[model samples]
Target: MLHEIVISGFGGQGALFAGQLLAYGALEEGWHVTWIPSYGPEMRGGTANCTVIISDEEIGSPLTRHPTAAIVMNLPSYERFEPLIAPGGVLVVNASLIAQKSQRADIRIIYAPANDIAAELGAAQMANVVLVGAMLAATGALQFETLDQVLDKHISARHRDKLELNKRALRRGGALAV
Candidate 1:
């Protein structure tokens, strides 16, 4: 199985972090994985994106011209990546930030109000976590337990207090996926 995905949004939205988590999770499952992050000059509010590929076989290259799926957190991300999703692929949309509806009919679309859900969870900065959860639910790309383990690896002593919140946020996003 091969899964090529792009996650995009503003820098502070945690797009890169989400991709990192997915990469870690896939690696834990013994899958070959690659994660490449990109961001503009301005850090926080600037455009941020990451490409992640998970495969069971040897990976020839990391670049994904047409990804299997896209996790988008804003309208700009949607506009940029929507056309790049493979036919019959999946698109996870953050309805809280994006106003335009997807025009593509060849792929599966899942909408979650990531920002709103994260805000409700009292971890507004975890909007990307919410989308990650939704992607987990929609794609079943990685097991929940795998993600839980990956989450533990990503958390540091300074942010241990947020472990539960991130876990909850991921579950909340999974619920929102459907």
Candidate 2:
């Protein structure tokens, strides 16, 4: 199996981190994975994105012109990546940040209120994790349990205190996948 995913948003929105989590989960599942991050020079508040490719076999490259799935955390990301998803692919959009609706009919779209859900969960920064959860539910590219385990094993020491909160956000986002 193979899955190419893109997670995008402004810098500091955790797009790269979310992609890292997915890459970690893929690795935990014994899959060949590659994560490539790109950001504008402005850093925070500037455009940022990451591409993650997970495969059961060796991967030739880390880039994809049309990703099989995408998590867009802001309007700009939605605008940039929505048209790039492969036909019949899955897309998880941050409804709280994007005011416009998608017009595409070929791909499955999940309009998750990630920011609002994370805020409600007490950490708006976790909006990226929330979208990651939604992507898991919608695409099944990786097991949700794998993500939970990744959180436990790979979360940074500084954010260890919010592990439970992150899990809660994941579950909440997953629940919205339907």
TM-score: which candidate is best? 2
RMSD for all candidates, in order, please: 1.3, 1.0
Backbone clashes for every candidate come to 0, 0
Best by lDDT: 2
Stretches > 4 Å off in candidate 1: 39-42
Native-vs-model 1 lDDT? 0.88
lDDT against the true structure, each candidate: 0.88, 0.93
Q: How do the residues 1-178 of candidate 1 rate in per-residue lDDT, one tens digit apiece?
A: 8899999998788898899999999989999999998745849888899999999898877879898989999888999999999998889999998978888999888888988888998878888888889888888788878888988888768768888888998999888766
Residue ranges of candidate 2 with Cα displaced over 4 Å: none
The TM-score measured for candidate 2 stands at: 0.97
lDDT of 2 by residue, 2-68 (tens): 8999999989999999999999999999999999987558399898999999998899989999999
Clashing residue pairs, backbone N/CA/C < 3 A, model 1: none
Compute the lDDT of residue 83 as modeled in candidate 1.
Answer: 92
